[model samples]
Target: MSARPRPLMAALALAAVTSLALGAAPAVAKAPAGDEFAHPDLKKTYEATKKYESEQAAIDDGYVRTDDCVEDPELGGMGYHYVNPDHIGSTDPTKPAAVLYAPDHKTGKRELVALEWVVPNTGQPRPRLFDHDFDGPFDFEPVGPHYSLHAWIFKKNPKGVFTPYNPRVHCTPCTEDHAKPDEPKPAHPKS
Candidate 1:
């Protein structure tokens, strides 16, 4: 068989590198099964937040534990949200406003599940990611009005990554009232 030319191979390699640099690579190439459609931006989110796979890393970096494991009666659970008030309203990938963790039944510990971007609704343009609008502008109790987007980088969500809830996630039924939102922390002023 005739050999392919080196020039052609080089061009193909360059194209692939360029595509990745421009964020045009296929999203979720290594994502869990059923999660291949996740947006390319999710790769960025994952890289930025993976450092917080240990919950303590998150707390040390200013993410406060919300008392609730947020769930929906119909949609499913979003797990426990540890929110960093300072990161709110920011779009920088490294500054996710929240980290989500779900209890691992096998290990009996919380495992990292997702990263969330939250922006207060104060008349600014709504935040967008994963090719979808952040969900809300709904009054979120003490937090007031805001919009949020979730990237399920660590867990597979058959419903799609940007969806606010994850059926795969669950919360242990608390013997007491351990699941409730504390008085909402005000979002930091946008820098």
Candidate 2:
């Protein structure tokens, strides 16, 4: 014959099973929409670069601004690119080659929107991270052929996290010329 279970133990077991069956599991914290860090690499990258949220801080760390704000008629705007020449070609996810920012329509202040990883094309298979492949072997001029990937960590990109452009990012101060992507891609402005 089986031994009888203790009353307290039986009660606890029943409650636990009931909770599980009724879907009353504990709640977990959720990262908001596109801001969610899907991988540890992304989280690490965000933590490492979050200080750049302040445009001044990014400038102090050697990120030089590009003259023209970037936009794609089809995909949408990518905002202003502030590139760190030192970070180019580095595979470390935390060290993005560029940071993207957009000027607020009213305030005209640049707000950090995204992070970009750029590696010069050296006949390599292609650089990839965060489960996404980099875009383009396009002529990056001066930098020449390169593959780039954008992480829309700071902004909600309806297209995707790794997409090169974001519909939500706008160039409030950008002129019409800079908004068109087809016109021979502009050269990175000399600092």
Candidate 3:
């Protein structure tokens, strides 16, 4: 009888422990380390993006009769527009290479989420471009000729409408010399 009660108590204790473990909130995954964009940089970018979004919202509300309609292109294009967040670039790999935190025009709030790099060819008259995507806690590799970084923040509106706010930051121009490090030539911007 004593053994039976002991086993039952043990079983109840095990069940309680299991319930507690299951009920606990899951731990958040840690962001990657050693990435050029660190936590502080990300925070700054997010703030800038939010500011840009607020500016856009003010413009939209003041200038346009309807939120969806554009009043005049000459005054400025209609609808919600987000300005690119300010960003400082660094050659160091451990620091944030670029940061973009923009607000959702519809929601009027800042959302910090993702970053994108756009590379354009200076030699071409047309807008030829290349794009690279990165999430937080990861390293970003510089690629293409004259690459520009654009950071996107995701936000949701009152109606649960989600949109991305994109702010652009220009990086140091990539020249042919960067691609072919062994060769050195004229200092003029790459054609």
Candidate 4:
């Protein structure tokens, strides 16, 4: 009779211990640090592009080259921002095209996104300049949970006017944090 009671107590004790163990476990771990997603190569790309821009600026004060390397704050520290070159209008500096990414608004996490440059041609070399008739109203799309991609179709010079070429897509995360508070905005916008 005592043995039977002892076994029942042991079972009860085991159940209690199991419950305690599970209860002590955490529901979620903290997000990784900044170094976790550090892309040295991307940083190098940014620096090199900046240097080129500076040199070009020195060459001609009026000469402004559009680059795809702008830092986006909305990505919550996962990727950087870039320009959408396909949207340039007739070499118009005022209407330069670009695409930027950051983090999702709902969750403070970076995501893979992209900006597509839809022009009238295809398969052109890099650094394709845009003209007035350049048919492009680029579309930006998200790639993965933490990467933005870009694709462009440009027109070739000389003969091809409306030929479709260069359908390229590349992905990169927007490693920045651009989130506003969830509170309602005031009647007047803050200066």
Overall lDDT per candidate, in order of appearance: 0.61, 0.64, 0.26, 0.24
Off by over 4 Å in 2: 1-35, 173-191
Rank by TM-score (best first): 2, 1, 3, 4
Per-residue CA lDDT of model 1 for 109-146, tens digit only, reads 66778877777789988887667787766554445666
Output the worst ten-in-a-row residue range by lDDT, candidate 1.
1-10
Query: For residues 4-120, could you state the per-residue lDDT of candidate 2 as single tens digits?
Result: 112112222332333211112222223445565756688878778877767666766767665456665455677777777788787788888778877666665666788887788
lDDT of candidate 4 over 151-184, digit per residue (tens): 1111111212222211111123222222247744
Give the local distance difference test score of model 1. 0.61
TM-score per candidate, chains pooled: 0.68, 0.70, 0.22, 0.18
Best by lDDT: 2
Query: How high a TM-score does candidate 1 get?
Result: 0.68
Model 1: CA > 4 A from native: 1-37, 173-191
Model 1 lDDT at residue 105: 65
lDDT, candidate 2, at 93: 87
In model 3, what lDDT does residue 27 have? 25
User: In candidate 3, which residue pairs clash?
Assistant: 32-137, 36-95, 36-96, 37-95, 37-96, 49-101, 49-102, 84-167
lDDT of 3 by residue, 1-191 (tens): 01011211222233233221112222222232332232345444444333322233322322111112111211211122221112112222122222222323444433233433322334533321112222122222222233333233322121111112211211222235333346663232210
Q: Candidate 4 lDDT (Cα, whole model)?
A: 0.24
RMSD from true fold, candidate 3? 26.2
**Any residue pairs clashing in model 2, and if so which?**
none
